[model samples]
Target: MRHAETVTFGGSALNRAAELRGDKADVLALNENSRSIALWRGKPLICGTNLDQLALLPVSQDLFSEADEPPVPPIFLGQSEDGSALFAHDISAWEPAALDTAAMQQFVDPTQQHHPALPDDHRFVELRGVMAQLSARDAELAATARSIFGWHRSHRFCSNCGAESRMAMSGWQRNCPTCKTSHFPRTDPVVIMLITRGNKVLMGRSPGWPDGMYSLLAGFVEPGETLEAAVRREVYEEAGIRVGAVSYLSSQPWPFPSSLMFGCAGEALNEDITVDPHEIEDALWISREDMLTVFSGQHPTMKPSRKGAIAHFLLRNWLADRLD
Candidate 1:
């Protein structure tokens, strides 16, 4: 699609300085100077405070948590405008209670502690707006953080030798102590596409989505399969539609447990959709005019895709005549 990169998370151009991950002192120095920051709920948590703030937390992991601790070595996320190095924190190593939603919300909202406002100079307020408006750069960083940390959590034992692996390369890799095997993080690729024969676009609903919520057909790219092949297979498998001449449109790093979404536009060779009961609950093709109504919140039964996701991005651009 022409406006593919104009998609929400696709637009923000955050510079991720990947070359500095191996230099411990340099990475630490950058974190020591960064200003704009936010925290993530899973991996890649934005530590709004400095090193001292981490020390001040009442429940440090070494004292209270049973999980294996992450190496103190930090990963370089990138840099702020003033040249301060952005760093990611694996709060995964911290005690659960210290990073729980309730506790973090209190930090974000200091009024919960009954503290008086200090002329609005609070750091939380300073960073709140930017954090709330999710950026493409932040989305990429968060996905990287979640995927790497999740790899660390699940791959602690070496698959080859059954030995415990230690974190290396500032959390980018795991080295098995006994077998000398190295493990790297993984991103599973998924294909999400809008199949259009003419004015109508196909959409489907999975078993657990919110009532009335439907989205473009999507499925994971299997081993050794091309992206176009995956799109065709997935559409056939889920809705019994024969897809042809699939074309790449855009992509998004969806961090709902680590997925890279490949957005595409495909041609449906057949119009009849035979819904696969096991994979989808219902399937239908909504016309362009009705899709506009759906986008405008006037559809009687269907709701548009969630805002931050690629499906919404694809559909919106398609409607705007920017995806052709």
Candidate 2:
């Protein structure tokens, strides 16, 4: 696919400066630079009514003034074209959430709400809701910020010695004071399969998704499993359909707490679907013609995957016969 790299959060080469991460003086100097981007909560500071897109704020922006609480140390995202440093600072501690049942949804679009605490010129919005509209560069930066900060939030204590760990390597690692063990950020691997038989593709939906919402069958790759094996296993486990030939398609960096989604195309050898209640709520085979309707939002019962996600990307390319 011509737009493979253009997928959200995967295209830009951030040129992550690993060596500078351990250098305290250099990392501190980079944080003081004017070009850094600050991420508050899960949202990156954006300029204007462009809720569909992200506009990074300068490190010197007044938005940092409201960040009174101590944030997890900034991560060195990498360098831009002119050798200017790009960093992601977490101000999540300053942003409080009023959780409700509505917050149960995995993805939220905050473009509709005006954050009263933020400056009038900028609003921090959820990236998943606006990823399709963001430029490849913006998406990549936002993903990096969310993933790194999320890791820090969950791994505050050492697993080895049960001691509190401190951030090190410019937010790339955590070091235990007691055991001196180091822990790095983790990216969970998942296989999202586009399983096909003749002219139809298999899709399924979890219990609580929006009405008519369906997506490619996906599951986490287990220990001692290859991507292909995971795809075949996930299909059979979820839909009870046997898969034969599985091949790689494209990949997307999904930063909902950091996971790498591997898209794959699989040829199904059997059509009968015995939906596993434990894995899937419903499973069905939709013909190509019906899929076109879903993509166009004209289908009566089925809706396409969320835009900018690997499922949507793979399905779109498959519809156009461009998955190579």
Candidate 3:
């Protein structure tokens, strides 16, 4: 697809400084520089008023050392325009009373309130709620910060010897000091397909989705499987439909704990669905005209997928003949 890179979290050309990952002195210098961004949890600091771009704070800001708390180590995100170093520092250990309730939620707390000691115009907003409003650059930065930090949070223990691991390579890897094993951040592949036959397309909804919410069928790519195989398998397993002639469309970096979604277009060989109750609650085919109604908010039975997700992007482009 010619406009594939225009998808959310797709277009930024971040200059990941791989050479400096192992340089202790240079990494420290960049951390102390005044052009770094301090991210609390996964939310990047943004202007509470504008909320369209990143509000990068200086490294020496009082917020970092508030209550006599030492600033956390910085992870180099790469150089941005003007050749200034762009970094992300995890201030999650701050443990402010305002954020006490956020610890219980599996996702980032969407509370937009300002930190008690921070400036009134600055606050942290969850990326999913405001991603469509952010510029491509800000989206990229937020996605990268979330993915790296999530990996660090889940990979603190070694898989090889069941021993605890230490951070290495400036947040890109973990090393087991006892077993001499090294672990790198992982990105699982998922296949999300637009299966079509004649004028209708296939979609399914998992349990717990909002009322009338439906999206393209998707599942993780299993071990040693090709993208084509995964697409076929997922469709068959979920909706009991066989797919053929799979073709790649576009992709997005889904950073809810780090996964890449490969969007694909598949030709459905059969329309009869026998849904697996274990995988999804329901599956059905919707005509193009009805889909248009759903998108326009005139349909009563279903609603289109949320904006900024690949499913919405694909369906919109398909409707407008922009998928080429």
Candidate 4:
């Protein structure tokens, strides 16, 4: 947790410039004047690509192509120290391609694509590789794009007035035509923790995860609940572990449909795990050494957490004695 900001995407100190969101003229001018820029789905975009993922897109193409092409909302990622534009694309429009594992696999497997234009640094490729090879920033960008775009597609109607809303503020907000209400993009807070007692850490596998894959216990923070309380409640509700002394570790923007995962390391007061059949298929405590084996691919029944996820980062640092 101490070296959290040093963690891949977690460390890129890009200037998000939240204060400038309202300055429409200056933003438009900056986008037009930016030297090194990337176009996502046609809106000008920027992001501090500390890792070379931004160059993965096949030559810059207008994000909004074709007369009938749907709108692609562009998010202002941030600016580099040299003032270069850093941006991200909402490829959630291409979600169907990602959800279809077969199609997604083809994009990553270099030998399979008949005419692959995507770069190796692309999120789709790095996701398929072994852990630690992919930078956390790239993963964050991909996830952000997917989640935000997915939100736009799903929340086209205003909840307050049942009227259609339009994309505004560079995909960061939506404005309802009927009630004149402004809705901002949402990142649901989720608590993902490594519940440890002695040398064993608690992990669980969801019903849909690939076979042998297990991760830290996690759940969304309910309305009006504090983060610490959410961590305690989630650990107990999902794994039946009574947690005490919850400590925040790190946070990651998980774009898998718009979520912000808050990583934590908590002290477990109880060892007995009564798995919630609805929340998790199975749960167990794995020793530190066993976790190392899992990380090294020596464990046959379990696969480590997804590379770009905060769970994987937390577990890796925890194993490396760097999470203290």
Evaluate all candidate structures by whole-model CA lDDT and list the values in order: 0.65, 0.80, 0.83, 0.65
Looking at candidate 2, what is the lDDT of residue 276?
Answer: 89
Candidate 4: tens digits of C-alpha lDDT, residues 138-249? 4444455556666777899998999999987666789998899998888899999978899989999888676788999899999999889999998888888899998888
- Those runs of model 2 whose alpha carbons end farther than 4 Å from true positions after fitting are 1-3, 24-33, 62-66, 95-119
The 10-residue segment of model 3 with minimum total lDDT is 25-34
lDDT of 2 by residue, 21-92 (tens): 768524454455536566666677665566645655565555454565553456777777876777776665
lDDT of 4 at 307: 72
Candidate 1 lDDT over 65-98, as tens digits, reads 2333533444455655566665554433433323
The predictions' CA RMSDs to the true structure, in order, are 6.6, 2.5, 2.4, 5.0
Best by lDDT: 3
Off by over 4 Å in 1: 24-27, 34-73, 93-132
Candidate order by TM-score, highest to lowest? 3, 2, 4, 1
Better of 2 and 4 by TM-score: 2
Q: What is the lDDT of residue 138 in candidate 4?
A: 48
State which candidate, 2 or 4, has the greater lDDT. Answer: 2
Q: How many angstroms is residue 210 displaced in model 1 relative to the true structure, after the best TM-score fit?
A: 0.7
List, residue by residue over 116-157, the lDDT tens digit for candidate 3.
777778777777878888888888888888898888888889
